[model samples]
Target chain A: GAGVSQTPSNKVTEKGKYVELRCDPISGHTALYWYRQSLGQGPEFLIYFQGTGAADDSGLPNDRFFAVRPEGSVSTLKIQRTERGDSAVYLCASSNRPYNEQFFGPGTRLTVL
Target chain B: AQRVTQPEKLLSVFKGAPVELKCNYSYSGSPELFWYVQYSRQRLQLLLRHISRESIKGFTADLNKGETSFHLKKPFAQEEDSAMYYCALYGSGGYQKVTFGTGTKLQVIP
Candidate 1:
């Protein structure tokens, strides 16, 4: 696409429910990243995908947070048994290649009620 | 452990005033520093990276290796300069290992 694209700019889900956030990176960007941003803080890295494999998933808070880049183009962030504390803006970014500047999308603001 | 620290959470300056946003990092190896900005209801975008050595929007940041700092500066602040500024770092070790500081919000009053 043009810039990075995230789905359902806002989402409200109940606790214990499952939510998925999607990201469509810019064309030809091989490195995709997922981040979480709280109300008053900068975005924190959650996971990074280089090509079809996850290059780094060290930042995932716990087992409930998972992500996948099946095709290396679009990615999805899945949260299982969501909690209210999970409420925040989920950001997605992608770079042309490794060690390059990332372009971010309009983040998906998730609200777990 | 590598970390980025942005001490000030809020800064207000009159238009044409000089502005500076502080950033400090702790890392064992070399650092790749960058400043990202977010305007009202906008996506986060790169303002500048220390490696590029280019200034954008009348702002510049010099990476001081001795102090482990990369401070953003503007000689004359404009209302458009108001935004959330984040200090980020990527180490030479991992390709995707990046850390960001708690952002500083700048308000340039016209």
Candidate 2:
């Protein structure tokens, strides 16, 4: 693909349900990231992956929010026992490691009811 | 410990007027700064990076290492410039993980 891609542009789920947000990074990019953005706010860092392993996840708000990039090309952000506060736009971005510009997807809006 | 702060949530300016969107960062290490823009209903895209020291769409950002700031500025704002702007900082968080500011909504009124 020419750019980063996210699935199901919008999702609405009831609290306590599980939801998975998918992201497809640009082919061959070695770095992938997940961020969350609340209404009228900028994206907040959640996690970063270098290949199959998460290199840094300190930004994740809690254990309820998790992300995985098993093969480095595609990633998924999983929210377990979703809460109403989890409602926001989940964004995915990719870059070619350090010193490269990040390309972001259109984002997936997750609305927890 | 690392963070980016964009003070304004919204900014409105007339076409052809000068515009500046402030971005300040807090990080212990050297910072690589960038400006990302999102137009209404469009994907987020890179506008420019301080390391490149290049201007795109008549906008430029100067990174002041001493101040830990990378503010985007344009001498003349255009109606097309009306969009959302986010400032970010990337560093050795293993693979260049970036921290972003809250973003500013730039509304250029004609």
Candidate 3:
């Protein structure tokens, strides 16, 4: 089976710009998660979706970050007015259950200039 | 607040030697501990979980509540084991968020 996939492997944009990153989870995975990894650091949890609604979003750093998983299989992470500090690799993962092993994507690296 | 700590940023070991990657965590309640590994050019993947108590790829970890630690260990090191390892903690009680450590890079010298 195909693993998780993310669009636009790399994206470079100026500060204060808006960007949207997309993630396509494995087929039939009900639990989806988003994370961000900066240089020399491990991935930081952002949000999680179970089915069509976000089950937990406490990891989101600020209001500028938002995500939606309307249909449940696909998710989009939106960052408004991106700052240079927001530059990092955004990762997406999915699993059969909430606490089950998660399958991760290759990640989309966002660079803010 | 829940947190994970991997003190070593990098660990180098020779093949066939014993290996141990330290991981310590802090959380108010019982937490599910996990070890995630990322090989070069590969996405991060689950190495093992403390609850399972099963060894994967010759690796195992034990959660010690008294010490608040969950360290990954293996009897013999393999060159293929070289990669980045991350220790994570999930607080099932509330928020359901997983906290990750800074990660340690393992270098296996042949």
Instruction: Please name the candidate that would achieve the greatest TM-score relative to the true structure.
Output: 3
lDDT of 3 by residue, A1-113 (tens): 89999998999999999999999999999999999999999999999898999888999999999999999899999999999999999999999987789999999999999
Better of 1 and 2 by DockQ: 1
Q: Over the true interface residues, superposed, what is the Cα RMSD of model 3?
A: 0.8
Cα lDDT tens digits, model 1, A48-95, are: 999989988989999999999998899999999999999999999999
Q: What tens-digit string does per-residue lDDT give for candidate 1 at B5-66? A: 99999999999999999999999988989999999988899999998999898899999999
Better of 1 and 3 by TM-score: 3
Q: What lDDT does each candidate get?
A: 0.93, 0.90, 0.94
Consecutive 10-residue window with the lowest summed lDDT within model 1 chain A: A93-102
- Tell me which of candidates 1 and 2 scores higher on lDDT: 1
| Deviation in Å, model 3, residue B75 alpha carbon | 1.2
Chain A only: list TM-scores of all candidates. Answer: 0.98, 0.96, 0.98
lDDT of candidate 3 at residue A66, scale 0 to 100? 99
Give lDDT tens digits, candidate 3, residues B9-107.
999999999999999998998789999999999999999998899999999999999999899999999999999999998768646798899999999
Expressed as tens digits, the lDDT of each residue in A1-113 for candidate 2 is: 48999998999999999999999999999888899999888888888888888988877999998888877689999999999999999999998875688888989999999
Rate residue B107 of model 2 by lDDT: 98
Q: In model 2, which regions exceed 4 Å deviation?
A: B93-95
Spell out the clash pairs found in candidate 3.
none
lDDT of 3 at A79: 99
* Deviation from native of the Cα of residue B90 in model 1, angstroms: 1.2
